[model samples]
Target: MTIDRPRSALMAVLLAALPAGCTPVATVGPSRPPLAVRGSTATVEIAPVLLAARDHFPDGAEVRNGGIPNLVGAAPVEGLGGGGAADVATHAETQALRYSVAHPDIRIILTVTEGLYRIVARRSAGIASVADLKGKRIAAIPTTSSGYFLARMLASQGLGLDDVEVVRVSPIETMAKELADRKVDAVAIWEPHADNALRALGTDAIELSGTSIYRERFNLNSTAAALADPARRARIVRFVRAVLAATAAIERDPRPAQALVAATGGFTADEVGRSWPHLAFPATLPGDLVDLLVDEEAWLAAQEKRPARERGELAKLIDSSVLEEALAPPR
Candidate 1:
């Protein structure tokens, strides 16, 4: 039976109200949305999830373009199959609170930080350290991991975005060139692009040291209703397992993962190799996940012009059961 528009709205309302671990009755066939993972082809971050879908996942999974916003917004928003949102999506933790405000049920299930995120700056710009970034123009994608990273890095050295000219460059992949051409002094960005910046500037390019300052907690997210649905949840778990397996494979022998990313033609083999090491695959959820969220919430809330939610409130966004089960030993 086709679900009428009225029933569909009602179902959405009902699903939104359900607890994070609860779901309506199981339904199959065309009415149910096909299980799909969503992410961006633009960044090197999505490679592990891509590998999982391509090799390890039992279901025929394919990654579509988009991120947390598309995942949290009801379908018709992102055009995921069967008029539903992506069951699982990949993005940085920075995206969580912004989207979760409307869809409080969004849960971060896995830490997808296959590597470290960074800031590429020009040595000619007198940028020897993170502190020197003050008063210089830096390009960053707003409300993204890269943006949040800029904030954290600056704050670490008693600087804020106010202290620097934060430039938002179009076709963010061009950020590297921007720095090399001196259009911007520095850029806080994810891999491949960060690698591109280094390549664009070569000896003139300096990656500011901030291993202790910040790292992108790129993650896999799903809705409460999806997690609550047994079948959907199982598929999601399987995909997480696949992601972990893929991470292990990438860790053991990155050439395969590098080839996979190269196969997409987004980045050259060298770009992937240089940037790939910057990422460390810790398949498990980080213990600092909630701590990071609580700290980042203030910045996100201020940026959105809203009051930050309580710490406990932010804590609800993580659902570790999926990771736990994914790592659990066979019975």
Candidate 2:
């Protein structure tokens, strides 16, 4: 049975879950209005690999594009089909899950990507480890997964956001430039951006890979309304299959995938190539997904002074049936 939470109730729950000293991060506004669905063609927010996979979809499945961040920010507002390539721990996904608590109109269905999230510090800054970030300026896009990864890495090193001066950068493309210009001592970011920063700084860059702290999961989240529609559901299933096939193709020969992502993502071929090794594409939810959510929830709760939710409550955020169906063998 699904629980339908009212928006106010959801906010209260989130507020109560905040850990002491954690200020609520400002909510992200959508880039535009949510995409309107037309017939069997569903609109989705996607990034990188999934965007590349759309070209491979068989007939009968049509997906319109929505801006990746806007997809998550707009889902509760307009109820679009789903948003892909969002980290499970990011505020966007967490907000979507909270919105789902009362609405039941949306749910996270699949994990499309996983990778090592890292912190790249300039050796010239006299930084050698995560602990060196103390009193230093760290650049990050606070609303995204990179921010969450930064928080986790810092916590692991017995530090917190308060320990360093945070330099907020937008467009993310500018992060590498900011680091190279000596505007920020380090950048805590995901692939492509991290690679871009390292490349810009050349031998001056020092990557502090906190692989033990973060195994980031990027997901494909869908609206329950979309899943409830027979035709849209079928199309979604096909879309998932296409994505899986793309994953295999990329795994087998990443050169083609690299070119695809480089073209679409605005990165050079060399940057994508450097970033590709750290990325893994998997179609199903991770077995430890709920555990990760629980831990992250607790951490967020502590930081925000909100009450931590029970594991079972967090588990309800995922609807794995769609993925299971996609993976199931035909009779």
Task: Report each candidate's C-alpha RMSD, comma-separated, in the order given.
Answer: 10.1, 13.0
Q: After superposition, which runs of candidate 1 have C-alpha atoms over 4 Å from their true positions? A: 1-34, 74-84
**TM-score per candidate, chains pooled:** 0.85, 0.74
lDDT of each: 0.75, 0.60
Tens-digit per-residue lDDT, 1-331, candidate 1: 0111123444455445434533322233554554566766556777787667666765656466666766766543222223336788877788777789888999999998744767889999998998899899999987677788889899988888899998999777689888888899998887878878888998998887567877778889998888999999888998899998999988887766666555442455677788777887788889888888988899999999999999899888999999988888845
For candidate 1, what is the total of clashing residue pairs?
6
Error (Å) of candidate 2 at residue 288 is 0.9
Candidate 1, pairs of clashing residues: 114-279, 114-280, 115-279, 115-280, 116-278, 116-279
Superposition error at 232 for model 1 (Å): 0.7
1-331: candidate 2 lDDT, tens digit per residue: 0011123443344434434522122122344221122110110112333333334453322223332333334442232224442211112344444444445455667777776778998999999988899989999865456677888888888998889888888756689999999999999977777888988999999999878887777666666666777766665665666567777776677665555344333345576677777776776788988888887777666655667779887887788888877777743
Considering every candidate listed, which one attains the maximal TM-score? 1
lDDT of 2 at 72: 38
Off by over 4 Å in 2: 1-55, 60-104, 302-305
